[model samples]
Target: MAAVPPALGSWGAGQEYDKQPAFQRLLTAADWRPAVKVAVAPTLVLLAAALIAAIPSDYQYEYRFQSAGFGERFGSAVSMALNALGAPFRLGYQSPLGHDRTDRLEIALRVLPMTVTVLWCLALWLGLRAGLRRRKAVVGQLTRGQAAAEALRTALVLAAVSGLLGLLGGTEWNPSGRAAKPDYFGDFGSGAQKSGQPLITAGSGWLEAVAWTAVLAGLLAFLVHGTDALRWAAWRSRAVRGWAVSALAAGQALAVTVGLSSVTAFVLVAATSESGAQTGISLAFLPNLGLNLLGFGSGATFRAHSGLSGSDGSRGDSSWGDRSSETDFSFFDLHDLTGDWRWAGLLALVSAALLGRVAFRRGLDAADRLRLAAVHAGALTLLMTVSGVLMTRTTSSSGWIGSARMEISQEESGGLAFVSVLVANAVWALAGALLVPPLLAAFRGRGAGAPQGAVPYAESPF
Candidate 1:
């Protein structure tokens, strides 16, 4: 039997997901279910955050049993648990430890959410980059109006994701004392509350508002620029160059700040505040695990293509023989497999695939389409990984911090929760510093190929 030529616009046919539509892409490529698998990490993170928010403002999950002297026994147990699970995501830049209970918990709880939020933001940036490229392709395939419509859809999704994450970080689930209990004294008493306004307002509210604004702007820009690239060749060309430079620069800065904030905040809070056990998942674990798998798979595929490796052995019995022995391999690099940097590699891969597919459509034997699939898949893997990690961080931290804040707001903990909340905020702020650079670097690859467009495959049902 003659080999089925790889499809260009849809998920690569003649490959594992050849039957799937391009638009149905999700967290895990292998899993087609819509529940949580497709949305994967980010969705999980969001759910986790929601759960954290759902915790009653006055509810406290306390584990206190001072059997061995003062706070020793109780503190040791909590701290131990935190240390163990916290290993994978530990950005670990702490000063000498301290005995401050509020301070320690604050640091531990804050790091995860801040790191997770920053990481998700990075994913949004990458999605924007991909959406930009995809829109450019549509402009070429359809009428200018149609291309614009498709581009708008892409931009909206990316923007929405970014907006949601920002909202997660900026908003506080547990309201404070004055706000939580407005009717201090009810029947037969004057309802003169000391503080009339909510504890969390203005600046915090403004921060979230601005975050939403930026998200919207980013989404709109990506749609306009991407479709524009296809509509007007001259405009598209300039837009591509500008988008590449701007996206890369922004990603680099954002990742760095996020990373640094996470690290520094953790360290400072761990040192000065009461230390709880390092608890919950880090922002680097699951997503990176996925990336590692992607990198290894891509590496194997590359070797196969280069003839440095052999076939799966079962191919020998196929009617087509081994003409596609090389087709089984991929061409993405390992270092370019994770972080924000993977976007650059994705663009390069798409370019090659687009050219190859066009050539193949016009009757040219080529491996470009396979390479492009490998790259795009790799980028998606990278995006999902980062998003997942960030989401995990957000969920884990939000629960801990919110619970703590509840305690403080109730005055049983003497404003300790408020302090912890601040620490968490600090950690989130610094995340952009530490994590963005390495991420941005992952996307930096040669970008000299012609732009590629993605289209739906004929065989896919969804």
Candidate 2:
């Protein structure tokens, strides 16, 4: 009797996952079951928003005209909930935030939806982690393609969830041709009073849904696994510290600057408005208002118009009240009316600089880091710009006596000043990656590659 050789299965313990075909390695069923986890955060956010929406119940009449029966009331609430769910599916810049029939929702759908999108990525990452644990792989080393392939499964699931939501909400079809129909894709803005609208307008939300899917999948691979992008990269331990610092610094700064400023403004508005109830009603619009602050920070701008009372000052036209007044606050200036927003702008600049420095110092050469920074900043800026463009909806009505004759209708974007913001961010990110590290390094009297911060990992408390 002697010791016997271990079974092949036991020998395969740590590396079994790697032996599988690429497709099987990635698109397996492991990640599918927990895909539903993606919805949890978003649902929670919507529920909280609903609670806020229902707090007083005094303004409940805004959504419901009479509400005699329970079923109708329930249906309307369900509709509103679905609207909350679907609202962020637009350009990802604007949230449903609530509205006063004409007013937008008070919540920023951007943060919640982005959280859900990250959760979607997390679902896949968790699956990979579980599988790696089985394989005894600690750092989860693998090709970028493998991680991307695994991510595709989760992305598909996310898309399916989005499609399901769209189907459930946008399926407003009418067989009776007697009434005015809202635009097929009109769930966000107005109701259709007519009939014969398309049976489905589900694609409206899918664009953003798909966009999130792509972003999440890529991030899951790059941030968690380091994927193929790690080929020329240094060891994770050596590099993770730098990467984590950059991310944490930027994130914390953004949270502090953007979050604090937005909340402060909201509180001030609530405190000062003439009526508390009226103020609460306007609270639904705070999401958009906060977004205004964000635009100031990021140097992006959108437009809004209001009714004018007096005649045109320049021409002194008799029908001066015929046109709505327009203004531009797209970028932050020293003399901005709101000082808080200007601070947000400064914070954003600092964050961008930190991002460039950290990302460049992580592992890659200056050129590669430059490319990475450009790609990261450029992609995000592009998304925001495009989303802003899509979100610029214009509505016009006659002046006092039914005349929009002051000027012709123009395709307006509410001032989504993406073009300028895009240029500004790209220049900042590019220059930061290319210039900041060297400048700082020279100041410290060390070469660029010298371990600079050696800070704790982003997820680490130490």
Candidate 3:
């Protein structure tokens, strides 16, 4: 080539462009690898946990169809995973009796299976740690802003993949393939038509996808920033340290007790059952069951409502009725199935006392102890509220037969019982903080010799 320009000379020499522009870098797979590496394993683990949890519940839908095949079960598992991640689905159905007489049921299942939730947290932590290590190896130390940007990028990747999975999993399930055809029911005579066959359709909305993205982003940000913030606060203030330690100890105590109870129950169920499905369900929902029991122990009551409503267009008649009942019960009640629920309360009280003693040993004075109790109470109450939100589930079924349309719905208690539980937990925490510490101090003082390395209340610096 004759006298090529500088740019053309480089091109003519067959030199590769080693550096890409920012926009072009976005399209490159190597640039995106770190984020994908951080997101993929955690996402897969979450899906697996969801699948394990879902497999046990396959029996519940047996009434809808004769048997569930692998594809149907897998779809259900993906749907459950999406729901656990806060995606909402709208369910629509049309009965064979009449096309115009359609019924729509939207179910909101906010419950996060404890097993899945725990596994997701663990996986995310591991993935983030590994990603951070790799980033440090490549680029040296990252500033807070850089770390946050990386987290955000990873979160976006995770959310996008999850949303895509939700779309793929939200496919409509039509049993027998007859429900998909609009005129299949038309061939049969009026009395010969199938009544129970419902053309069911389910879909997750755009809003749900957006909401899931925001939630995932927030969770990642918290993991990146909130833990450091909390540590700084604790280091700066004795009150914060006492409260943090006490709340953590109390939480651990309660968790251990409830976890043991759940494990015991699971063991019993597994020992007695042959198929092991129930045991799997128990393992999946261990956290939910524990929280429910904790709420019950704190005097929370669960209210259950079931209703049926119907209208007959030909007869020009409509009827609607619902019945509501409330009770203070826990998973432990299943052991005896009795009205006496006093054991739950007693267990709670004992846990409180143990946590209180643990808090006292952390060298908190009267004021700090009081603060510890208040903070612990508030923390526990907030946890209960969040668990309620997560554990809430609603399901409704409706169908049309001839000129009659009917709907049946059942809802479980979620946030409604918080008030009573709050009061109960506060009382128990206060009693534990105030009473047990003094008693422990007095008992220690009366000892023949002070316990080695024990800090006496009088000598303590609060």
RMSD, each candidate, Å?
25.3, 12.3, 7.6
- Give the TM-score of each candidate: 0.27, 0.51, 0.69
Candidate with better TM-score, 1 vs 2: 2
List lDDT for all candidates, in order: 0.31, 0.45, 0.58
Output the TM-score of candidate 3: 0.69
- Number of the top TM-score candidate: 3
TM-score of 2: 0.51
lDDT pick, better of 1 and 3: 3
Native-to-model Cα distance after best TM-score fit, residue 411 in candidate 1, in Å: 18
Compose the digit string of candidate 2's lDDT tens values, residues 99-217.
21121111122222222223334455666555545433544455666556545654565555545544443222222223222454355333432212222111234455445545654
- State the RMSD for candidate 3: 7.6
Q: Alpha carbon lDDT of residue 40, candidate 1? A: 38
Q: What is the lDDT of residue 444 in candidate 1?
A: 54
Judged by lDDT, which candidate is best?
Answer: 3
